[model samples]
Target: MASVGITPLSAIDWGAPWLEPWRVLGEPLAQRVTATAEPVHAVLQSAVGARLPVGFAPQSELPAGTAYEQHIWDTGRVPTRDNLHDFFNGLVWSQFPQTKRRLNQLQAQALATQGVRAARGPLRDALTVFDENGALLSAPAPLWHALRARDWQRLFVTLRPLWAQAHLILFGHALLEKLVYPRKPMVAHVLQAQNAINKIATWEGWLCAAMEADAWADKPFAPLPVLGVPGWWPANADPGFYADAQVFRPLRATQADARR
Candidate 1:
């Protein structure tokens, strides 16, 4: 189910090492011994993943990568393992701060451009997702860097454009905290709706719905090459505990009724 088709997404085509990181970001594992996937295995290395107790290796394996990637992979891959709650907590601690730091860096570079200078493509894209009323629905990864530095020039440039295309959403209050936080310059933090496949999207929705999840969602959002290897989601594959169709469908209908 992992290796299905080739997607047109740049995340898939980006070529090695750098791309491997994003691929790692996008995959989900139920057990360490995945369904025989090389691309997936490539992303999960001994260096990065948590291993099964000698007895459990036959049942499952931990997805691996850099220290943090290892942690993220472990939580999802080893479902039967103990302490899901703590594992989930540790994963959050690892990801959000790094995301924020990167956003801050990009923001600084964008702002440094000043009145006469031009912002980079990635920098410009980050601010382009804001709302007409000055709210963020979702933003690109680089936004942290852009926000931390207050890239005024890029900010102004992205302002009007984001305002025009402002139908935004965010979801998963718990998981979303890492991607954004209080006092953060987030433009779109939450949204209430259903993507085509029916998922309670906050960040994952933004990724799969807006960012071509069919191709890019299972992979990391970085621009690196190789991406450690490649991994993907099957069209019929379930998202996770966060997205259960039966549960959300009823909830969505309730929201609709209330709106009416």
Candidate 2:
């Protein structure tokens, strides 16, 4: 669903910090990802009902006769910040030392998709509908409530530790959960534009590393095979795993086909 090339480069795990310039170019791109709502909305909507087949939630435990409902729920469980943190912390955090750099790269890439929204309601509505459709995937009650209320500062303080440890665990291979996030800028912007730019770039570095493993994927990409050995990960999809979105978005005439 991500349509090749249209997927941001940072979405892929290319071993290390290879795209430094792209990360540099990524600053405004990330700002634009936040500036508008439509693109994000489209992504959220299209993704609904598609999350499970891709192995999002643990196999939905519907009655044996209701495999269809099970199919729907599994596919529909869109990744959230809580679920995401669980995935990373469960597997990679303490072990992956380079996770910080990886997450910074992801944030930069997500922000720098340099894409934007042209309208409103669609974004918020899609998310609401998705929540309504799926059985609520359990989340940390405190964090979920804060996010639901749109409490930005509290959400930031609460999620910061999640992201911090997550960066250490998950390599920047997936966009685990971004349900609740910081609203205002994390730091004061200095009067100097260059200083402001530097601050944002720094933030991007941390962001990309934590939230971007296949953050580019339309659904949760291919389900990762379970790794039995502690902190062990099976081989990943090669470089260019979800890069299609970049090329795909540009070639499309409109947003009609862009939904998940």
Candidate 3:
């Protein structure tokens, strides 16, 4: 039996808030591994039942009623590079398996009920896009305020310094299945630090578009289409679309320059 030899959370500097959830989940397992003779992977595997999907198996389809996190692990599809990202995702599964499961259930339900319509409605579109390559952004209050106000400058530049405080949680197990190729620093949703802000800002636009039809004024954290960002998807990535300097402002000085 192989074990990852779970390390102490204090000793590991994740450098990102998104990684915190994984650290918390893995901490106890690491302690158990240290205290007992069982392997680390074995210990984690023990917690997962046989009904889940494999993270490594690309052909692995979600069985009806299968738990989402379990399916991800069963498929061995976690886009972990044996690095911080990898470990963080593992920890996320350990801690929020139920939430993860719920998300998957929503996606599955949408697919079964809606099929692949050209326009899969607003909420359904959001759910499909997010489950495939969606990211959860736990941004600061100011950032959300800026987004809600449509103050692109404040959200993209003025308060960019606080971007470090933002946390990104990826929920794209199907997207991770394609990681067998050379993994780019930037994936479908986001691959870089700048992409985080850009993607979130763009997702805001989708929310706005959806609101035109749906009464989603209550669900702020609902999933969004990552590719909805201007200059992201091919059809919407035209220079003219990103030319709205107000929305996609150019980065000239440092984010901290405004404060100075």
lDDT of 3 by residue, 169-205 (tens): 5545444333322221233442122234534345444
Better of 1 and 3 by lDDT: 3
Name the candidate that leads on TM-score. Answer: 3
lDDT of candidate 3 at residue 184, scale 0 to 100: 19
lDDT of 3 at 190: 29
lDDT of 2 at 116: 27
**Model 2 quality (TM-score):** 0.18
Rate residue 6 of model 3 by lDDT.
Answer: 32
Q: What are the per-residue Cα lDDT tens digits for candidate 2 across 147-258?
A: 3443433433435343222211112222222211211111110110111222323433443343333432322111111111112222212223223332212223343245
Quote the lDDT for 205 in model 2: 42
Candidate 1, residues 39-114: lDDT per residue as tens digits? 3233233323443221112113443422222233333332222222222222322223233223333334444453
Which window of ten consecutive residues has the lowest lDDT sum in model 2? Answer: 185-194
lDDT of 1 at 50: 43
Stretch of 10 with least lDDT, candidate 1: 222-231
Estimated TM-score per prediction? 0.19, 0.18, 0.39
